[model samples]
Target: MVKRLGLFVIGFSLIVVIIQVAIPSADGRFEQADATPEKRPFLIVAGLDSLTNGALTHKTKSRYLDTLIPQMHKTYGDGGPGYVPFDSIYFKQDHHQLKMSRRLKEINDLEPGQYPSQYSFDLKGLYTNKGRSDWLRFDLKKDWTYGRVFYLQQPDGGSFKIGYRHQKFIQVDTGGSLSLKTIELPKHVQDRQVVIRHISGKVTLFGGIFLKNGGVAVSRIGQGGDLLRWHAQLNNAFMKQWLQQLKPDLLIFNGGTNDRYRSSVGEFRRHLRHYLKPFEASKCQILINAPNAVKYKQKRLLNFIHSMKAYAKQHNDAFISNQKVLGNTFQEAQQAGYMGDWVHPNHRGTKKIGNQLFFYIREHVLPSYKKEHAGF
Candidate 1:
């Protein structure tokens, strides 16, 4: 009798287990209860993009990095750029990829600031413009819990009027040049579009845009008229301090166009060594991005590119060739309607560059990282 009773209980328990596995949740959905959280690798890209100073702008329409950011995410998933959306005014009319002014979520790497570094290359900057009103905009992607904004002023400081859409939020004077501002947003106005218009004075750069809840905080430290050698001019202490604060897992130096023509092979290598010294001590993996192909100096350009590749091999670091991937020459890229000007890329051109970068990272960088770290 005891054996029979035990058998009945075991059968009942089996039936219960089967039912539980087959049944759906309260809302009629199957869910993975033991799913692990995703881990994202931080990636920072520094250099010039198509829209820098409107190099290829036609009828005010130009190519912007914003167009490329989303493509990076789509191609590589989380392991790609790992971008998150935020609300901000996009000069969509000024860009080729964007056909109309629309309000939609777009990925933006929260910019970061390094003081006394002498380079305000952050993605957000206030250029001198005479128009309706000069403004910097931000739209929160998620329900905002907390946020921070950092900016570097020019020798001529200015005041900023902050607001959301059509409402006036607050106004603050930047006080002076080469300064930083850390402002906290109120929860009542969370998840709304924030606009900062230059009321008076000159604010050259808007450095940091950090959200309490966001994806990989990759800062866009790109600047127009900038070269790798220019970075070496920064105060050593400031450079070290700033890089330490960023704690970048990956650092990509996408520079050369502004200064490549002036340097010979040996000189270029020397410039790289001196420029890279500040970043060498950092634990971050450094990747060197080749300059875009120029119309002038074809043979010399190829030699320079070869030298860059050789340097990457010597250091056991990654080197991506924008010139080879984009085009062998400006004429070739122009034939494909990718070149808007002699050097910078058009909207289609920028897309191509972004795609190539996506594939290159997938083919070279991610596999090794995954093998060592399990996943990212």
Candidate 2:
């Protein structure tokens, strides 16, 4: 009997060792393995609405994107804020680390009798500095190794000086005619702050990008009152160029609150397909998120949700219904204190929704993705 008990103990110890060796760690790495883990940055592009733009939320931290960003960092590592636009009039970006100070003039790309498709580059949101002293300073909180500046070189374009850490500035001349230009930072340079000084002529700034060595990058592209169909208003060439550059791992389409009263089910379907057309060639994962329940126009919202779910199913895309997380009905959500007004959610509601979304992605989405990509 003593000999048998000792043998059993030894067998269990071997099983424990085998289990530890086979299973990957919480950081997505195998134990005692030399094979480098997936270090490539996982980029998530979210095209949402006011819920993500922080228009209805009283506090900046209460925004869903704010909650999602930190949670994603905890798991996938921090890749720094992905994209930072120049204008804050419509879209409220949450890059507290980077600060800009200058009297910049905002320009809309929409031209009379001409759609965005006619434009060769992105002109939707632009900031111009005509003054020689006019400067847009970037104060970064963390040390970043990679950065890029997006701008348009036009006939009236001027020169701008880019300096690192208050050092000597490098002057770039925006060449004549309309075209897109990208300024990439030297890979060896570790940057803390960047300043764009207006040298001469008109310097039109589109936006900027900041990234770390590895991990996940979540870029929030949202406006206060944007609809999915409004993507049509964006320049197709610019859209393709940006997507090719971004090369997102996952693309999330979130909108419907503004369209609930205005769009029909058929129109919404067409709009979603139109928005997704550019991404089909990329072969990246797509996630369609239904908007939260509202007080009025509940039927219209439900119809939109149903259409979105069906479309996602048809296209083999992932879908999450906010109604499931918040409440199935308007009254249910209101009673649960998730609804702030007839159309939007309060701070508490957004926090709850955001946390739930994080959980869902970590638990369900990531597992399926790993399995599909053979432990990617």
Candidate 3:
């Protein structure tokens, strides 16, 4: 009888072990970002503040992003109910509400040693050339979560390294709708002439790109330089870690609206080259969204858009024209009940902007990407 009981217990234990072996692990969760035949490519829109986000709608807070993303998603038959990117609100984080000047200083007060996880990054394809550098490639694996500082060193030797230097960083007024921080570069170094040797600081506006032939520009309040600088800062400590962890396949850039708000375009651009130097190393495609028309003085805005159009043509970088969307113009956009302040479009307008850019990327950019990546 005792031997029979022992045999039964052994048999039951074997069945339990088998059941356990058949069950899958409970902690395995990582969805792939594969390109779908039905879905179009992604279009990342950076620098979305109040004025640039388009106007707000009259009834709901429906802005451009809200309207345009769904419209494009429907047109492509990808996004629908219960399906949204970023796992975040369609229209959230506006830069207009923050105190950029004051809060920026406060953020700059952090200590580098106080945060190491915020500084994890990978520098790839680092090289130099004739009196110039090609910051071939680098990756912010999981470092995007923590807003850290960034710096750009020159080829052939130079200084002016600016970024979230171990502790300090810039703070942007996102108005609670945007997801980027401003990281202004250091003052230009006076060598033979007024040279912008470095552009360092804290920022998190991904998919931004550098210029082709020293073509970028930046405009800080009193940077002394004339041209504009590239606006690519390393994020806060942990913020950078998130970016590093996310590991974007491509990082596009969309700016030119905020570039107009600079004190000097020359020095800004000079310093921008420094910021872009790292991106160029990565061979990342930097998309530059040209300035669109705002209300009041239409011609001036139109002229700037034209200039940006020319810049895109000359450089052959990606360019989206919110200015050309005549129906989506400032007047039409406001009338569409999507203006936040008659200058910037609201959520619906931002979605529209995102949709337009998304289509452009799908139609014009991704086909080449497919061919290049062997039908990926």
Candidate 4:
């Protein structure tokens, strides 16, 4: 009996060791794991205005993302660009290769009663292509085994074809009620150009294309002149579905620039909470990033920042203030060559902002995450 008990204990210890070796750590380390990189850590930065689009100062690459993304890849393996917006109104796609047969009509206006709104009816970050032969091609900068295409299914929605390399195109029908849909490619795709071709109907694309393989991925979801309340107008179910699909390990909300004058403190808080409710049950960490200092509405912007800080504290989440790095006042930032105008940051200014965020993650976020997920 004593010998049997000892053997049982030894077997249990071996099982535990095997489990640990099979699982990947939150910091993206794995031992004796499969070659497939499906469970890589993902970060999403969702913001408004300049955070969504670029600053007034023209540039070849994004202001902060160009600096931040490369740094992150160096530290935690390369995971392809997280989200690529289809709209090119104010955003330039320079990180990857993209070719469109023809420019798609960008849509921002929403019909009356389509959504709950008090001031704006624009859909913000959605684009549609109606031409039957129109096609968009995306060539990834890095190798990725997984990809997903996000779009909206509306009453007048049409069909489209998605294919990669020499494989057959998959036809997707979007003739249904208004809702969000995704075409996820789980198969391995390496160094191949992905194409989306319009077949017959009008297809509205949202949240762009998501590509990742392993390691760390940082995605952005921003719309010029976006407000916290505007996000509240989206269907709760739709938002929840989208969040589940993205499955971000860290979600950052960057706002207040556009919301300062438009919404009162209480109103902003309410809208923010409503917008975040879908993520309440998610295991992903939350970060609230306050907008940088602006020349106008200093008092109102400060109020919004304070509210966001308090909310972050109450939720036990991380908070980063752009003012801490950019400057306390608009004049100070302007003098430092950070301001492209009264509100937007110049190229140099954006680089500073990106570096600061990367430092914060290295100093504060990663350490805590490593501690919490130490064993696996």
- State the C-alpha lDDT per candidate: 0.45, 0.58, 0.31, 0.59
Candidate 1 vs candidate 3, lDDT winner:
1
Off by over 4 Å in 3: 1-45, 48-252, 265-277, 296-307, 327-329, 332-338, 373-376
* TM-score versus the correct structure, for each prediction: 0.57, 0.76, 0.41, 0.75
Judging by lDDT, tell me the better candidate of 1 and 2: 2
Model 4 residue 326 lDDT score: 81
Task: Kindly give the number of clashing pairs for every candidate.
Answer: 3, 0, 122, 1
How many backbone overlaps does candidate 4 show?
Answer: 1
Candidate 2 lDDT over residue span 1-376, tens digit each: 0101000000000000000012234565533322112344567766556666645336322246667878988887887666655554433244344334455654433441142122322223344546565777665544455666666666877877765664445567775766556665443254446777764666666665567756677766645555555554455545556666556677766777677666788887777776676666565678777777777777877888888899888888889877787898878888988776766667777777688778877886677666655423
lDDT of 1 by residue, 269-354 (tens): 67666556556777767767666666766666577678778878888888877667567787877787776666666677666666
Worst 10 residues of 3 by lDDT: 7-16
Could you say which candidate leads in TM-score?
Answer: 2
Full-model lDDT, candidate 3: 0.31
Name model 1 segments beyond 4 Å from true. 1-41, 49-67, 75-206, 211-218, 261-267, 368-376
Error of 1 at 38 (Å): 11
Off by over 4 Å in 2: 1-39, 56-62, 89-103, 108-124, 129-133, 141-143, 176-178, 187-191, 367-376
lDDT of 2 at 201: 60
Residue lDDT tens for model 4, 1-376: 0101000000000000001112234564533323234555555544444454543336312246667778988987677666655544433534566566654544444431143111111243344445566777767655666556666666877877776756556667776776666665535556777777764656665534354555567765544455566566655566566566566667667776776767898998887787667666566677777777888888988898898899899888789887888899989888887877776776777788788878877787777766755431
Which wins on TM-score, candidate 2 or candidate 4?
Answer: 2
